[model samples]
Target: MNSRAIKILRELLASDQPITSDYLAHILDVTSRTVRDDIKALNHSLHMHGAKIKSTRGTGYELLINDDQNFRHYLNQSLNHVSQEQALLDSPDARIRYLVKRFLLAERYLKLDDLCDEMHISKSTIQSDLRSVKKMLEKHDIYLDKKPNYGLKAIGNEVKLRFAMSEYIFDRSETGSKTIWRDQLSTIADADKEQLDKVWSVIINQIKENHISLADIAINNLYIHIAIAYKRIKSGHQVSLINQEFDEITKQKEYRVAHHIVRAAEEIFMVKFPPEEIAYIAIHLLGTKMVSQTNMSEAELENIMEKQIQIMTTKILDALEAKMHLGIRHDKELLIGLGLHLKPAINRYKYGMNVRNPMLQDIKLNYPLAFEAGIIAGIVLEQEMDVSIDENEIGYIALHIGAAIERKKMQSSPMCCYIVCASGLGSAHLIKYKLKAVFGSRIEVMGTTEYYKLKQIPFDKTDFIVSSVPINEDLPVPVIDVNAILSDKDIAKIEAFVEEDIDHVFEYIQEDLLFLNKDLQTQDEVLAFLVDQISKTTKLPDDYLKRIYEREEIAPTAYGNLIAIPHPITAQTNDTFLTICTLKKPIDWADKRVQFVCLLNVEKDSKEDLQHMYEMLGKMVDNPSLIQQLVQCKNYRDFINTLLAQN
Candidate 1:
């Protein structure tokens, strides 16, 4: 019924054995009923496409196509038809060539034997494939080289590689088949389709007017434009291009220059331009007929466009403000685009340029929606000016913005925490720590204030009052008073009051799992690797590692085998990083000597990571021969290779 459902179905089809409905539901993150509905929907869709998706009574759905090879061939042919219709020269051979080229691009040098092994093909077949690929490269005026001793390599222009990849991956219809868009759109309800059609119409008009070539644009942007058009229509606004009459002037040099400028604009603004606007901009800057030979230098274009766009942006903003009667709000999106355009000019006129505007700082301090947003903004700004902003600086910015937003929001319907301390700052500090730990960094703690202070201090803003100290009066807000320190009884009460809230916060902030560097030697080596990875990934204080080691002293991870697994079941770690190592010599572990050791450093709530770790460990322990191979490994890379090579 949906893209996610289709993905689940595909996964089921690819699986070796039948999958249960419950398993499908869990994997899809949907209800079992929803999964059943999805199966029915999938069956209907398959039938419409002249295929069938069969489902067993107790088992899951499977594609019932008799010939896998024929299906693949048909799919490829359909893709080729779409490509030709779109004026894209894509064929089955081209698709294979592109895949090979992409694989080659990832490596500096590749051995023919290793590649043949990787592809699971014969030497002659690989040789033929390579020859075809070499010709394709040469057609683009690129060259592939092979030395007598060395391996196959692509050399020459870097632009050629980038351009080739961009065109092949982004424009090819075969590639589009791999995406969710086709499945999702096909299954849309009739009512939704009508709504979508209206949105698409506006987008089509915009594209036509702007002369935007779909060939050059990414699918992501195309999807975004359709979404924006839908939103605009829903809001009862005319979905029209801002600059509709812009003429297309596509010279190779100018077009490339313009594309770069527009790309910079999009990055700075964090917005995708309408297809038409992108096309118009490309033509205007490049020329009418963009020849491959004609290319503008980045420096020349950046210098000129910087001054021009600044004036243009100012005028555009002024016109919008005047026409809309809504005051222009200087935000990160506006400043970034403005800064991008004016960066070169600012660099040239460093001393004389007016930098007195408070807008930049104001935007930085106020507008970002997330911690990542501030980090990205700072990175973009630093890159524009050829400067560096360290992680600490970015972190500081995020904190400032976070604190400011928290403070502003707290101004209305503020949260109150009553510190229940019998005496001293130590007890108060402990209570404060526990409260913040459970609630968050944002909870306001009114420490050891008298009952009079609770009455005098704005109680209207107080959401919850927690106190361990003696209270004479009944508080206006929910009073959570405890007799002693955070005992089991006290913790139970606190948890009961805030279980839902805590769960919601944890859902948002929880990390998935951190994979190991896939490098380590012995079980001891893996233990050491885990320690190092935990330090970097978590950014925990130095003393935290010492605490963890001290805890380990009480119970060594060696569980009576040649294998050892060391871990702490606490939320102290940010993510789970597995450090697997094979000892050159078997180490005495518990009762059994172990050649392999895996150290799992997981967050307390990370059940997924723990389960995965458990499964991997179980698999390794079940096979003694695999352990022997791992022990023979000289380095971490070799050890990982040996581990993966196992059946």
Candidate 2:
């Protein structure tokens, strides 16, 4: 049976109350039918072992093994015997030999009296065994230290000790009893079986392939494979065999090495690779290493990877179009991965590539596709680039562009801002209002704090600061002093401060042209579309529009003539993006009918971006003729063209 199914059964058995199939399905992230199938498989396996799994209506399956205590006792006895046999074979030295013999004979914890009586040794000799035991325990991360009242005891994480013991036992008997080891290992839950199998298979195969006829390959490979698999699994991938085919004589050796590679990849990525991919990569790497008769340097490996990535990009593009039925320009994803690979090398060079100035001739020769992909990807992902025409610019551009795309996909922001005042109440209120008015609401604000209360604040939380009062203390956040009284100049200054604080905020939005309605319609239609898009993107409820309308009734959206902005005051938005609707016919807004209406759904926390948006709006509002042209726009294309021209 598959390990996944076994895991489900184990979970079911462990639960005190009956678990529903649905609950199992959710835990396994599979359908109820799959869970049922897994249960059936578990039952079949149990039956073969002369055991039965009991199931009842409306409840889950449970193991119904008869004479549970006897079974456990038998298993323990078998383990003890194996341990004794291994101890005899491992060490024949006088000191170790005596300790091993005494340990095997002892039925319970060995007191000094019991140890002396069993071995007919002196107290000092028994004390010497204690010392040896302490030293041995250290190797297993166990401490055999004396306690206040207790004489001496082994103390450590119990699970770690158990794992250590399992490894030790497995290592001791390399070839004699495979079934005994397998039986003992079966005690591990089904969920863990796949992982165990993966580690076991890889190491065994490596040992055979490498022609390493050592008895300890199992233990050595186990340690390396487990470490690597853990890394890969954590990084979001599965572990699998690296290679399937090896000559019978060399299969085991190659498998062992393959496990080590899987572990290495896991460590590097800090994520897991799926079992199948792990297996494939392991096998390929083994074959490559064997054929080449040389280890690949990091640079050489990267070069080979670059070629593979090029192929992957082509495949992904084809898959997107053919299978997904979507037009995906994956140049950005490719460039991002490439840039990540080259990031270390780039850091070595002084004066990073200038993105704004492109050296076409140089780019065409060194990195043609990567260069183009990087520029386009950067534009799409970061919404800006500054390339200069000099010194292998294409590689650098590609790297940054790809990095930008990745950052965009991850939706990460580098800068965080905080507003500070005496009580944190008034300044926070004023700053939030002004900043939201300008930026929209995607930027992050750490939180407002009082000047005196700054000591209580977490420094890591603050990235940039806005405050009314002057403070002498140096802080990590970029401090901007502003007047308590709000004014047009104060607003302008705040806008400028935001731009300085985060250079990318406005530039990214402007470059991406996020506010542009791709297929424009009427002004109202555009507004509705914007609302719909925001709602879909943010997963806002249907009642959000109603809430906004109710809020508007109490206070009009329009601040004044030539400035009509509508928004919901509630902190319901996940992100802040503006929707500027230009009407063919003017709509009545507050005191006067306006040709254009800008809707701002500002998130409460994003002050920097909001400030940037406010600045852009302030510039657009300054032009009355431009506003008139927007109102009289005949079509969507004409409106876009006019807006672009103005910008």
Candidate 3:
């Protein structure tokens, strides 16, 4: 089977219901006949692996596993193989990536004609690809320096060049990833992959022996940086520090660790690192890992955190509370986490280094509210410390803020539930025990009762019903159906029920704020229209427009799938609401195109969870069908109905 078949199998595995071939074709952008053919081949392969795609007439296809163990065993090996067989230079993204690696690794200037011939593309095609390549390199302050006849060579600061190479080249070349946040690097070369693994082992041993608590990503980052340094040094290139403060870094604990690491690496690779190189590596350690012992208490860690970081963290949380009122001001975890993260972040800012966040887009898309809070935190840090914080640093801050939001959610009163099973007492009790084990104190199972006797249980006290059998009768509260013996999906459904609140999202929507399709051609025009439309009926801050623009300067609010959510850099609106504008034509955002623009305003000093509102908007971000409906809606009533239908 091809990649499309693998995609079909993946989709089937994710959904419980039978999926129509047309629906699969629509999502995969293939013909229905092609989908059928792929499904046929996919089903044939599945049968031998203890699973088969069951075709239901008039409905579509579903996956049925005959033996879970055998299927999982086969899946592990099959997916790994499929990953290795991916076409590296087939897609546009892959092509641009190939060109970048070519430029970064080139010793002499590259000839445009040679690249065109090598990639088997016309001159115009390679030139177009180079445009994107140039844009990407420009992000790291690297630009293509054109030679009269020799073609082009990438020129930038050596440190920046290494940063770009690690981010774009070595970071993604390997498929193996140990964590979900981002892929970690252990080796840069496949032929010499084993040689690099020895170095990785050596680094790990030093970290453990020193009682250092470096995250997976940090270790991986160090791996890439060290490998790049070795390569650069071997080529007679060393990072030059011009007017950088190395005296302060030398006295730091990480500097000693970096010294030990390089001393060990010298024996393994037969390469001697200069003192400046050691300082650079130490800078990385400070940025990635904060030295901590296993026996250290939270109080000890707090005491160790710099006084300046403590003040900055306090201001960050205070700003968040005053503006968004996210209800995380008192979160102790957030307090400690922010302080620890910021101390190293100060070093990164001082060094003028670009922090790479692979999860920035996902963070922006999924956690817009927290990302907004991150923007405010960055602004506060800038004001207090006089340092600029970019989107990548804001993303790391968002992770901490997002965690605080979740922790607050978990600490809230547990939702009540009554376990109802068709079988009279015994089965209900069995399910009750399971729920208790799974949820702990997060959910309070009020009581267990038969479906027929569910009325005896007080409905007023219970928030919802978790039934072993389907409940046909409508009740005052919600009903979540699960199997007598819970499966992972059943647990997920209940978790979603507890964590999400999407029903009341329209409370923030105002008919006067909704603008259907207008002739806005630019981002500025769209923002002006939304602000003007809302300002006519309501009083807004004099600098409301300025705030939104300031936020844009920090990061482009345009997330992909034809949508952009613009808001103030810091919350200043009197009430939480959304002023929306949909453009008749797409406008060019900084990085992506935008048509649907949402001006998100949060109430000042208000205590409300923006998760549900953000979740609704997040779902719409990548939904092609939903966005089309939003774009084509003609009036206020129709537009609202479309959003209502989304529920």
Best by TM-score: 3
Off by over 4 Å in 3: 1-90, 171-194, 242-244, 291-302, 353-362, 385-390, 413-507, 515-564, 571-576, 581-597, 602-647
Candidate 3 C-alpha lDDT tens digits along 1-647: 45567667776875656777765764555578989988888888889989999898877788999999998877755654543225333345557888998898776899999987777778898889899999889877899999998999999888888878877775331223342112223334321555566778878988888777777767877877887888788787788775447788888888898899888777777888888888888888878776443244567866778778878889999998877678899887788788888877888887766677778877886777788789889999888878778898899999999999888876789889999888768778888888889888878999888877877989999999999888888799999999887889998788778866454677788888888788988888888888888888878899999989998988889876568998887677778999888877777787666778888988766677676787688778745456767877998888878876766
Models 1 onward score TM values of 0.26, 0.21, 0.71
Better model by lDDT: candidate 1 vs candidate 3 = 3
Cα lDDT of model 2 by residue, 273-363, tens digit = 5545444333333322212212444455456445544443344344323321222344454433443333322211211211112233323
Of models 2 and 3, which has the larger lDDT? Answer: 3
TM-score of model 1 vs. true structure? 0.26
Please tell me which model should have the higher lDDT, number 1 or number 2: 2
Question: On TM-score, who's better, 1 or 3?
Answer: 3
| Descending-TM-score candidate ranking | 3, 1, 2
lDDT of 1: 0.46
In model 3, the worst 10-residue window by lDDT is 173-182
Candidate 2 to truth, TM: 0.21
